[model samples]
Target: MAHITAGVATSHVPAIGAALDNGKAGEPYWQPVFAGYEASKRWIAEEKPDVVILVYNDHASAFSLELIPTFAIGCADEFQPADEGWGPRPVPVVKGHPALAWHLAEKLIQDDFDMTIVNRMDVDHGLTVPLSLLFGQPAEWPCQVIPLAVNVVQYPPPSGNRCYNLGKAIRRAVESFPEDLKVVVFGTGGMSHQLQGPRAGLINREFDNAFLDRLIDDPAGQAAVPHLDYVREAGSEGIELVMWLIMRGALDEKVTVAHRFYHVPASNTAVGHLVLENALG
Candidate 1:
């Protein structure tokens, strides 16, 4: 049966993607951010999973005002990089793990999670930035992906508890798949910063770090945090942190923190990255 080898959580700031694409990663301002992922890059190369269940949100790209999927899974053969105003970042097209994705969707629905199974999508930076951070500039992504797009753009996004429970359901789906595959689940986005209003440049390092500690040591308690707290304290966009609970819940009750990196001022955002491995079989 397929097993979840690990879970990764990271902030998916668009500026990070531009830094990598424009060859600015080596600059002092960007160096620290890139340094945060060096260990992750090497680790991924060594522990190459058969598939990655990338959990991220679309920034008004695929889903706009007309439609939004609370939870969407990509079962397409491949996804093209999205053109988010500035044009598509120079990156390899994402190849999807269709067989696994389809199986996951069916099982998730059967388990009572209403998921929109997408056959096509143009992946935005939320999905690609994390890949770039982990894989660097591979000519092609090293492994197949199953894009799990969560709707964090709209108000009333799925609650922290809901995401956490869905992750448990995902774990059941993954363990039941009768295939010899290794999977890694990634929860991407947020370390506290707001992108709009008078507080466009908010960064609460204390709050961000405190949240990380809770996520690692007491995720159930972290899941209890309300949306207003994330918005009011962390920043409006910081609500993205709720997605981390999904990755946390997918793992065994105990996990070993393999590597972690945190840095701030990444173009109006605080970047955080974590790598956790299941401590139990």
Candidate 2:
């Protein structure tokens, strides 16, 4: 049976993607952010998961006020990058694992989690940036990707507890699959930085670090964190961190911290990444 081997969580900052695409990653300001992921790139290359369930929010590129699915699973054969006013980043198209994706959608929905099944949708930086950060400039992504687009952009986004429980359900679903495959869950977005309003450039390092500590050591505690706390303490955008709980929930309750990286002021946003492997006997 298929099983989840690990979980990865990272911030999907758009500027980071732009820096890589525009050949600015080597600049002094961007070097540290890119450097932090060097070990991650190497580590993922070695683990080589067969399928990745990438959890990210659609930044109004694929869905706007007109429509928003709280949780949408892409079951298509491929996903094209969206033109976020910059004409789609010069990145390879995203190939999807329809079989596994459909399985997840079916099982998750049956598990009482309402999920929107998407046959087609253009993926935005929220999805691609994380891919670039970990996989680098590969002509094609190394493995099949299953886009699990969460709705963190709208009001009343799913609670952290809900996301975490969904992750648990995903693990159960994967374990039930007949194929002998390795799977990884990626939770992308957030490290406490608001894009607008009074706290336009907020970066609560203290809160961010504390959250990470709880995430690694006490995920259930982190999951219980109320939505208002994320908004008031981490900033509105910081709510994206809830997505990370889903990735955490997919893994063993006890996991080995394979790699952890955190940095500040990457495009006025905090960039955080974590690689967690299920503890082996």
Candidate 3:
């Protein structure tokens, strides 16, 4: 089985990317955002994993209310850039791990999880922001990427438990693969901040901090938290916590915290980052 080298969680604040590339929004607050990812880049260079399974929620760019998939895996050879209001970030096209992705798709469906498999998909800032920050657009990406999109935009998205189950299935899929590879799973989006309506600007330090503590120590307890409570308390879009369950499930009961950082109110989003390393075999 391929070793899971690392896990990363980050908020995909668009302005952060813009600030780095064009000095467009390089506010005093945004400096920390870029500095926070410096270690991630260094770690990736040191570890140099072969595949990255990006767990991120789309912001109504590719998948929408017309067809809301609980969890969708990308099997495309290349993913295009989306026009995320500002524009594409001129990054290298995203590559897919077709052999592993397809095999995982088959096994997931057989295991009673219906995951949408897309041949064509365009990723938005939610996924790209972290990519650009962690691994800038070289002639090519540092590694092949398996884009995993979770639904956090539309109402009544997948439940927390369901996401946890999906993560378990993903672990099985990775373990079942025939070839040797190094895999890193990333769960992106939210420490807490709402972007729509009056409920926007809501920040829950208590809930967010409690979540970080529970995520490493008591995953099931964290996974069992009501998704609605996340919406009502953490902010509507803050329900993106479900994606983290996927990353958490891939990990063993015990993991060493490599690093962690947190900040608030970055363009109506709470920005945070964490790296988890599973117990050594």
Give me the candidate number with maximum lDDT: 2
TM-score of 1: 0.98
> Residue 135 deviation, candidate 2, in Å?
0.5
Q: Write the per-residue lDDT of candidate 3 for residues 1-281, one digit (tens) a residue.
A: 76576677777877776776676544677776667777877877887889989999888789777889878999988888788777777777888889988988999999998889999999988788878877865777888888899888877778887887777788888988988999888888887878779877888888887888888888888888898789877898778887888888877778888877777767777777878887772
- Cα deviation in Å at residue 151, candidate 3? 1.1
Ranked candidates (TM-score, high to low): 2, 1, 3
168-198 per-residue lDDT for model 2 (tens digits): 9999999989998899999999999898999
43-66 per-residue lDDT for model 1 (tens digits): 988889989999999988888979
- lDDT of candidate 1 at residue 246, scale 0 to 100: 91
* Deviation in Å, model 1, residue 106 alpha carbon: 1.0
Model 3: which ten-residue window has the lowest total lDDT?
Answer: 18-27
Task: State the C-alpha lDDT per candidate.
Answer: 0.92, 0.94, 0.81
TM-score of each: 0.98, 0.99, 0.95
Candidate 2 lDDT at 251 equals: 91
Count of backbone clashes, every candidate in sequence: 0, 0, 0
